[model samples]
Target chain A: MAEQDEDSLIGYDPLAWMHRSDFNQDSRKAEVGESEVDSSTELASSTETASNLEIDLDQAPADASEPYASQGERAVLVLEPVLNIQNVSVLHQHLMQMLSNFEAIDIDASGVTMIDTANLQLLLILKQTAIGLQKSISIDFPSDKFIEASELLGIAEMLEVDQAASGFF
Target chain B: MSARIVAVLNQKGGVGKTTTSVNLTHALAKLGKKITVIDFDPQSHLAVSLGSVDPQKSGIDKVLLEGVSLAEQSIPVRKNLNLVVAGPRLQEIEQLTDGGARRGDLLRRALLDGNRDEDFIFIDCPPSSGVLVANALFAADEILVPMTSDYLALQGLSHLVGTIKKFESALKRPYKFSLVMSRYIPTRRISKEVLSVIQKYFPGQILATAIRETALLAECPSFGKTIFEYRPGCRSARDFMALAEDFLQGRMM
Candidate 1:
């Protein structure tokens, strides 16, 4: 739990609130001596700790992180190292933007170290979209992670990739 | 090593079972352990927690009802975490009375048919003792119980224990059982009392780390995010990560 020691953290002691002066120690006896109870809680306590735990759920993407360089009429999309559902929608938005603006798209996936099924599905959709428009969409410099994930999902051929070039083959 | 097939189970509903299932598996996945979580619960809270909102998603029901392979339905949500949502037809399994001996064996058979190469396969079971839960019991080698510190929770634990005992007795095999204390409020007197009561009965069964009660744990699911993604730096996230480490290091009985 080294992350807990970070300076940004507002520390919370779970048992610290029990030491309040108004709390009675005499009424602390257990009513059920040996009887068991059902497990699972609907929610957490509404004690003093609740106020300090405020969170912002409207976490929309701050900026367009998906970078693409225009090469003539083709847009070369450079994928990040880690791609999962967390960032899939942003990448999808960028791909859709690229597809509508350009005639051809080239995905540069050489940097991807981790790719999940959601992103692979996104790329598959991109490939299909490009084919539907009769435009070119090729995965250029596909990383081992990208190729391995595509192969694992049994979509390597659909994405038009030959694993023979990679060490996985 | 073969995958550790665990059923995140409790006969009683709402005791952080789905919360623990989603976060703990995500924590393990972040630690580079390949994990696959199955929504054995008909309510589909596990899938919703992982952000799969589609009611029509193909899932474990297909594998059980139609004999489809488990791996075919896996959706990789995180880097190493794959999810098998409980499809809409999953509830139909509970109403089923035809399979007889084959009913309980559907999940186990489906598991045997697929080779997902996961380090852990966690089944998020519904909070009732039904056929769906029976299927999970047949498939899982271990039962990870998520409990809260309350007398009612203890009663639920006891009933679940009886169910497990019956299975173990009939099957002639013991499950690797462990308990995780969730939504714990150390400041509450009853919480401490309940903890002591549980400790007396299930000695060495409880995990060292207790997930303290926090609003963030309850709020994350609504946003379709785990605690890690919801607030990575929060105490709840830290607790979950430590809990995951505790699980990885075998810090339970």
Candidate 2:
């Protein structure tokens, strides 16, 4: 038994071991354990470095110097690409948040590709809120889907899209 | 059994669409059919005329927006007739016309799942060819077009028929279209002539019973009751009852 064990150990070739060492080294970073250090200063410093790296990478492009290229114009709050009852609460919260910033809320629904009853209700609430605030808010660029949906739901007059917005008091 | 959806539509305003919807619903209920009337009209005159409900308090707007169950929003007006009252949020419901699940079929889906044990469902469509009207058209298996005897009435009928045809083509489902003459004065020669024209153009589509011009029909809305409840002996009540019988029996011609 002892002789057999010695022979098996020797059969593990040294040349094969040398070849496998490079593969192990390549995986060393992935095998690292979490650091025990909890210092706020170190964490802050690391975060600052990461942010700086991000900014540096972002600024590398020559077009970054263009006025609207880096920061981008303040994105207009538009209807979500999809509108349904499942996410209606989220849309409502989003609309409320948008309304908090500007007295006059203009939603660009051009991006909305789909809608349901729940989303329709959100639009209604937004309109009611605007009415209560006595501010002018408008929904713009209604797609064919929007027009067809409005006609079916029987609230076409309520959507303050371009045609109707002109008459909004 | 699939729920029977009846849509009351008239593009011409003040042609008694609401009145017909509310009264027929009541009449149908009296004949032992469980009925749910969905007032898709933003104006919500049907809710007011039937239940004396204030449009603001109807809460239908929330149902449409929040996915509230129809049972929760529906108000029971009588033994067999229930109402899903219209809400003020109708002012903005149009904005939802874009993409969504059950976009055109929202009301239909709601009513099917509403579980009211109703055999018949009536949708009171708005005056215009808007989303509400589309919803009604999409939901209904049968459509009742109310008209008066006038030149514009004929024009309105043509427009409504065109709309129905479009809906049928889009949905790929056939609908039973019936004409109900309202404010019909039998003595007037023009009224008789127009009725004949309607009969000729729409053979077997006109109901035998026509609602005559009666002040009682107009007055009952103020009292928040159907002609049956308000004045059962009145001519309007008789006409509606006969119309209801004709409707249930499928004998309109």
Candidate 3:
């Protein structure tokens, strides 16, 4: 039951708040019931964790560590190898912002040298959100470190990574 | 495999909508197919007949309005049969969804949200065109329209058929419909005449076994029981039991 893994998710489940009508069309946003309440609550609980993540992104001065940057219609969310309590906020913001303007989300996991169960859950949630919004997401460039972390948890399939292409050992 | 979701419906009142839902599901359960009956009718007859549920506690409404899980809301009735009672408040939901898709597929999303292990899921819809009926159509893979033997029932029955067709085309998903001729008075010559007309219209769609008008069916619900529990040896019970067999036979057929 990924219940423990679900709890370790450093951010909110965007599905909890985003209703079917919210993504029906950008022009109209209808109030969804449970998804909205649940997502909002999880988002509220992760505020401190998210803020801490924002601070870490500010401290790291790497070109890839810009955390989030635009790529025309598709947005790139640069995740650190060790998401922990540090860079989850950056990922959450990008997920929440998916409904705003982005047609697709490209998760750049090339720098992700380390990841845990909580981080795996975050990736799953992002995939789920993309499906509900009728949007696309491509994690086509995960590093060897990311693949190793995913394999340790036996969730290579859950992340939808093509093993041969993904170098999944 | 998931449960086969079935909605028993008719636009007209007193067409054995609740009667068939209560008795047929119990009969199906008796045959060893896991069953759950959802009383979506605002009248709450299905709940009252099955017994042990608050008339105002619509289990589906809680799933829709209060974020209550479907499994949590169900109350066990007969062996292998669990019941979800309907409240008068359900009518309010129909009024709300008639205008738009703002809260559409509430039932579909809820029923499909988790693992529903029942072999058959029967929903008794309210007697009209509204959100409640729409929800039933959206969620149901099959529809059972229980109509009385008469020419007057033909138009309303046809309208309901058309509604099912429109839903299938619009949703791009197929839904099967079967007719159960209820309240059949065997001695009446008009009964046969109306049935002949129905046969011409529906052909193989009509169930061969008819629910004859009987005091047992009418009296059982008032006592909060179905035909099988009330009088298992009676003709009414046999008719429904045969119908249940018919349903089961259709499965492998």
The runs of at least 3 residues in candidate 3 whose Cα sits more than 4 Å from the true structure, single-residue gaps closed, are A1-169, B97-99, B251-253
After superposition, the stretches of candidate 2 with alpha carbons farther than 4 Å from their true spots are A1-169, B100-102
Sliding window of 10 residues with minimal summed lDDT for model 1 chain A = A48-57
The full ranking of all candidates by TM-score, starting with the best, is: 2, 1, 3
Tens digits of lDDT, candidate 3, B48-162 = 9987556656587888767788898888888899998775577677655132343547788788866778998999998876567777877899999898976567657644654
- Which residue pairs show collisions in model 3? A16-A35, A16-A36, A16-A39, A17-A35, A17-A36, A53-A86, A81-A112, A81-A113, A81-A114
Candidate 2 residue-wise lDDT, B14-119, digit = tens: 8889989988889999999998888788887888898657646745566767778878977788989888888888646655545442555566666667445779
lDDT of 1 by residue, B1-253 (tens): 5688999999888798999999999999999999999998888999999999999887999988888888889999999999999998999987665544477678888888644589999999998776777778878899999999876887677557645644553344568889999999999766876686567556788888999999999999998999999999899999999999999897863
Q: How displaced is residue B212 in candidate 1, in Å?
A: 0.7
Find the 10 residues in a row with the least total lDDT in model 2 chain B.
B162-171
State the DockQ of every prediction. Answer: 0.01, 0.01, 0.01
- Candidate 2 versus the native: TM-score? 0.60
Clashes of 2: 17
